[model samples]
Target: MLKTGSHIQINDTTLRDGEQAPGVVFTLAEKVAIARELAAAGVDEIEAGTPAMGDEEVEGIAAVVSQNFCTRVTAWCRLSETDVDAALRAGVKHVNISAPMSRLQMRVKLKAEPDEVAARVTRVIGYAREKGLEVALGGEDSSRADLRDIGLIAGAAAKLGVFRFRFADTLGLLDPFSTYEYIKRLRDETDLPIEFHGHNDLGLATANTLAAIRAGASAASVTVLGLGERAGNAPLEEVAVALPRTADARTGVDPTRLMELCDLVAKASRDSIPRAKPIVGADIFTHESGIHVAGLLHDVRTYQGLDPAMLGRRHKVVIGKHSGLAAVRSVCAAVGLDLDNSVAARVLARVKNIAKTTKTLVPDARVRSVARQELEGAETRDMAPARAELRLHP
Candidate 1:
């Protein structure tokens, strides 16, 4: 179990791995702006970009590095000196030197034995440290690698002054149970700070990431909106909010400003935010069901699992086919109209009919019109008895 008050660090890779999303490209200004926002949101680190992509990419990374953000800025590099040289040109003080750790990756991709991969790790990491750059080692596909080999590779890197070891779920294959066990086993092997970099192929990245933290990983890799190659990486917003709630861990990321940051990334990446996306979606805090609305009207806690107030937002009740009298009254009152129980019932009927016909929620004007008609009918019926009594008495 994760100890309370343990500080969990967020290493945001939106610019590096996130931009790897197909057809997604961020200009230099966009990169710098994102890094600035991440820093302001109290991200512990920013993975600026892969400088080995060439000079244009290097220049962009340099622009971000120039800001000298409060958060540490790092570049991603493969197990090659050329990659490290490119990062050096970009003016970053930190680098994550990655090497394939799995035997399959070693045989198919590198065409080398484990010893050769180990040799490359030592050389690249040593060069990075000699260049006066802080280093972290990424064990690519560590989830599939042999545990004994991971211990050997990571132990070597740790002895050579590497500060952290990143265990990446490169294929997004591991579930929460395996994730916990993976990190737990690795934790017993090395004292180096472990970071979990999870993918979302099975839509379990957030859960797996939290599990890693619970298993003693100190950091997590995240993107602004789970943006990455294939499905995506773990979403920053989900993990940030989930940490404090699930593990009693704090990331120092302001949950209230998370939506703003997500919007900025969405606009820059041209990736639309899903209406139902957790933590930063357009409709997560909206309610429409009659039962839920009634319960919320009586006590907000009844229907609320996570407080919207924490994100600088409030819960909203929208009228639809599932709406009830309580919801109709709540909507009417917002528009400066009071609906009695009978009138509210009538308006709710209209709301459901309109919603069914349109296949959407009813608007305020339509609901108000229904309530006006109901009130008018009530007044007409009330006057009929008085008028008849006056005529008979006269």
Candidate 2:
């Protein structure tokens, strides 16, 4: 378990790895605007972009850097002089220099042996330091790499004065239990700051990230909306929100602004946020089930585990097929209709019918129309009598 007051660094890579998502691209203006918002939200760092992409990307990164936001702006780079040169040209002071760590990636991707690759990492990182750039060694595919190789990479990073060592679950293969054990072993091996970068292919990115922090990772790499290659990376919102509750780790990010920030990123990236996405979703806080809505109406804590107020949001009740008399009464009251038991039953039937046919919650206008029609009927004349009977039954 993490001790109290663990300050977890959130290094957002929305502008870098996020753009790698197919058919997603943020204009230079969008990049800077998003960076500004992230800074205002108190994100610790921003992985601006891959400077080596070309002049356009370099300019975008430079624009973000020029803003001089309180957050540290860094560029992502491969282990090569060309990539380092691109970052230098973009005027970024910090760079995450990544090299493949797994045996398959070594032979297939880099075509080099473990010792040779380690030597190359040393040489490249050394050269980067010479250029006065702050460096973080990205151990790509660390989840699949041998524990000994991970230790070797950490050892190299420590010896070269790398500020951080990132363990990349590039394939998103590990679960929370495995992730905890992995990071715990690495923590025992080195005193250097360990950062966990996770992908969400298995829908475990946020879970695995939390486990890593609990096991002693100092920072987490995340992307807004979990935007990245394949299923994307760990979402910034989920990780930031979960940190405080799960690991006793604190992030500087303002939870209230997470929805707004994610909206901007979704628009810029053309990736719509899921309606049930954690924290920033449109309907995650909306309750339609009768049991849940009734419980919430009684006491919010009875049904809500994570307080929506933390994100400047509140639980919402929608009248649907599953809604009960409590929900119907609540909606009627909101629309200024005094609903007796009989009227409530009539309105609930309509609500259920509408939801059943349309497969959606009854619209407010429709509910009001139904209520007015029901109230004008002869059955409503007995509403007062019905309530007396209802009270007696209670």
Provide the TM-score for each candidate, comma-separated.
0.96, 0.94
Q: What lDDT score goes with residue 313 in model 2?
A: 94
Off by over 4 Å in 2: 17-19, 379-394
Model 1 residue 183 distance off true place after TM-score fit, in angstroms: 0.6
Write model 2 residue lDDT over 9-128, tens digit each, in one string. 999998884335888888999999999999988899999999989999999999999998889999999989899999999999999999998988988988987787888899999999
Clashing pairs in 2: none
**Per-residue lDDT for 134-195 in model 1, tens only?**
99999999999997888888887887899999999999999999999999999787888999
Model 2 weakest lDDT span, ten residues long: 385-394
Candidate 2 versus the native: TM-score?
Answer: 0.94
